[model samples]
Target chain A: MSLSVRKIVISGILGAISILLGVTRLGFIPVPTPAGHATIMHIPVILGGVLEGPVVGLITGAIFGLFSFLQPGAPFFADPLVSVLPRLFIGIVAYLIYVSTKNINNILALVLAGAFGSATNTALVLGMVTLRGYLPFEVSLSIGILHGVPELIVAAILTVILVKGIQRIRTSEDRPPVS
Target chain B: MELTRNITLGVYLPGETAIHRLDPRTKIIAATMLITLLLFIKSYEAYGFFLIFTAGIIVFAGIPLSYALCGLKPMLPVLLLMWIFQFFLYSTPDANILFSWWIFTATDAGLHMGNIITLRVLFLFTVTTILTLTTSIVNLTDGLESLLKPLRKIGLPSQELVMTMIIALRFVLILAEELDKIIKAQMARGVAFDRGSFIQKTRKLFPVFLPLFINAFKRAEELIVAMEARSYSGGKGRTKMKTLHMGRVDLGAGLIMLLFTILMIYIIISAAPQI
Candidate 1:
C-alpha cells in the first residue's frame, strides 16, 4: 500500500528527532554504567508506532538504524547485523504492545509500549552483538542489565508523558471545526 | 549550546573536484559496494588496501584530511573502549595468550579481532562521510528516487520513502535548534541539568522532552495541512523540475570503483582470516 502524506511526514520528523538525538547526544541519559550512558533515541521510533502506525514506526526505525550504522556510536555497531537489523523491531513491537494493551489502560499501555520498545532495542542489539562475537555473552548480559533497566524506565516514563502531551495536541488539531 | 555545529552527516561541502562531479547514483552504489566488501574483510591486507583506497578518494575529492576526520574525534574514545573490550573478551580455542589479568585475558585472536573490527568501523564511517560530503541532499534524494524507480512496480513506495528520508535530513537541524532552546529554557528556570544524580538528571529531561515532542507534532500538523492544501498526492505522476544525467565522469568513477572492488576481493580471498 502507498504511504499517505501524513505517514511520510510524521515518520520523517520523528526520524529527524532520533537522528538529532544521536548527533547532539541529547538522547544519552547519564548512567553509572561502564558504557557511560543509556539511550532514549529509540523513543521517537516508539512514538512513531504508537502515534502513526507500524509503517511509520518501521521507517523511522530504519532511519535511526541507518544513522547509527553509518556514524556508529560503538565499534561493533559498524556491523549492520548489530546496528541495523535488530532496530527494525523497536517500533513494530512498541506499536503492537500499545495496541494490544491500550484497551486495558491508556497510561499503562503507554508505559508497556515504551518499556517493551526499549527492551526490544537493548535485547536485540545486545543479542546481535553477542551472536556476532563482538562481545562475550557474559559481558553483554551484564551490560544489558546495567543499561537496559535505566533505558527501559526512562523510556516508559517519557512515553507516557510525551505521548499524552502529543496526543493532546493531535486530538485537538484533528477535531473538526464547528460550523 | 551549539548543537547543530557538530552535525556533519547530512552536511554537504560543495566542490568542483572529480569526486564531487560524479553522479550521486554512482557514488551511492560505490559506497554501498565498499560497505558490503568491508563486511567480509577479515584480514589486515584487505583493510590496508581499503585504507589506501579511501584515502585516495579523500584526496581526489579535495576534502581536507583533518576535516574528513574531525567528525570522528568524539568517537575515538568509544572506538578505543570497544577495541579494549574486544581485545580482553573475544577469544577462540587454541589461541595464544598475550596477557592475563584478573579474570581478563588478551589473546592473539582477540587482538586481531579488535584491530579488524576497529579498522572496519573507521573505514565505514569515512566512506559514508565522504559520500554525504560530496553529494547534496537534493541530489541524493533525486538519485535514490531514480534508482529505486524500478522497485515501484513491485509495490514499494520508493519515491515516498525517499521523500521521508529527505524530510528526516532536513528536519534534523531544525529539531536540534528546538532542542537547544528547550534545554536553555529549562536551565534558565533552574533545572541545573549539569549537576544531578542519575535519576535526578533523568527527571529533568521530562520537562525538556514534553515540549520538544509537542512542538514537533505541531510542526508536523502544519506541514501536513500545507502539503494537503497544495493538492499533494503520492509520487504517482509527479515530475521533477530537474532531471539527472550520468556523464563521462560517472563512467570513469565506475571503472575506478570496479578495479578497486576486484583488487579488494582478490586480497580478501587470498589473505588468511585474521581471527
Candidate 2:
C-alpha cells in the first residue's frame, strides 16, 4: 500500500502511547511487582499487528523491546531476542487467529485469539530467557504460568472490544450511502 | 520470570582495555569456558580465585563495582527466597541445626548451601554483565552471527536469527519509551494510577495494556510489509562488511584465563566443599 497520512498518524499515536505505558512504572500490582502489570500497554502493539499484519507486528515488537532496553534501568545483558520472538509470535498468532475465524463471533472469539497470541508470546520469551540461564528453572516456569494467565485475561477482554470496534467501522465504511 | 530487565547478566563493559578489544568470538568462547568453570567450582577458595579473576576483568572493562552489582535488583527477591527455601528445606546427615522456630529449622549445611549458591549467582551475573557492557550490540551480533554461520550449512538460518536478535535488542529501549508515552496519555485523562488499592490499581491497568498490545501487533504488520517491499529474503546469502579475528589481545586474555582456571581448580581440589 502507498504511504498515507493515516498510517503516519496512527503510527505516531501508537508509538507515543506505547512509550507512555511502557516507561511509567505505573502498574506495580503486588503480585507481579517488579515486571509490573500487563494492562492495555500492549494495545498499540496489537493494533500494529491488526493494521499491518504480522511483519509490522514483529517490527512493533522490536520497537517495544528496544523501548524496554533503553530505559535507564535497562539491564546490560538484556536480550532483545527475548522481546522480539514473543511479540513476533503475537503478531503472527493474532493475524492467523483473525483471518482463520470465518464468523466474527462478536468479541469472544477475538478475545480468545488475543489471549492465545499473548500466551504464545509469553511461552517463546520465557523459553528463551530460561535457556540463557538468567532465570532459574523453577522461577522461569512459574513466571510462564503466572504471567500467561493475566495476559490472556487482559488480552481477551481488550481484543474482543478492539475487534468489534474495528468491525463496526469497517461495516460503516462498506455501507452504500443514498442521496 | 524473564524479568526482561535482568538480562544484563552477560553484558561485557566496553573499554579501552586489552580484553575489551579481543575478537567477539574469542570473548564469547572464553566466557563459555569461564561459565563452565563456574559450574565445577564447589569450594569457597575456588570461588575466591574466580572472584579475583573476574575482578580483574571488571577493572579492565572499567565497570564500577556498585553498578555491576546493581543488576541483581530484580533477582534479589528471588535469590533471597531461594536462600530461604534452601535454608528450611535442604538438609544432610551431618547437618547441625543452628536455629529453630515454629516448625522451621535452619542448619549449617543449608546455610553453607545458600551462601555458596547465592555467591555463584552473583558472580555469574557479574561475569556476564561485564561482557555485554563492554561489547557493542552491533559487534556482538556480528560476532555471534559469524560464530553461528558454520551451522548455516546444517540449515541453521543464522542471519535471520542474528537479525531477530538485534531487533529484540532494540525493543528493550523502544517499548520503554512507548510505555512512558502511554502512561502520560492515560494520566492526562485523569487516571490516578498511583492512588489506588492493590486490586484497584491493577484494574486501572486495563486501559494501559489494552492500547500497548494492540499497537504492538500493528507495528509488526507494518514492519513486515516494509521488509517485503525491500525484497528481503531469509538468510540464504548475506555478506559482512567487517570480519572478526582473534589477535594478540585474545592470547593475553587466554593466558589470564588459563592462570585463573588452574588456580581455581587447585582451590576446588583443596578447599572444603560447601556441600
Q: Which structure among the candidates has the greatest TM-score? A: 1
Which residue pairs of candidate 1 clash?
none
B-chain TM-score, every candidate?
0.94, 0.84
The CAPRI classification for model 1 reads as: high
| Reference-based TM-score of each model | 0.96, 0.65
Cα misplacement distance, residue B57 of candidate 2 (Å):
1.1
The lDDT per prediction is 0.89, 0.61
Give the per-residue lDDT of model 1 (tens digit) for A1-179. 79999999999999999988887877888788767779999999999999988999999999999989988888888888888888899999999999999999999999999999999999999999989878889999999999999999999999999999988887787789983
lDDT by residue (tens digit), candidate 1, B1-275: 66777777788999999888888899999999999998889987778788888999999899988888887876787788888888999999989999999999999989988898898888888998899889999999988999999999999999899999999988987888899898888778877877879888888888888898899889998999898899777678999999889999999989999999999888877775444
Worst 10 residues of 2 chain B by lDDT: B1-10
Chain A TM-scores of each predicted structure, in the order given, are 0.96, 0.76
Q: What range of 10 consecutive residues in model 1 chain B has the weakest lDDT sum?
A: B266-275
Residue-wise lDDT of candidate 2 within A1-179, one digit each (tens)?
Answer: 22232333344445444444443433223455444344444555665566556655655555555444333122211345554445556666776776676376635557656777777767777787667544556766776677667766766766666666555655665688863
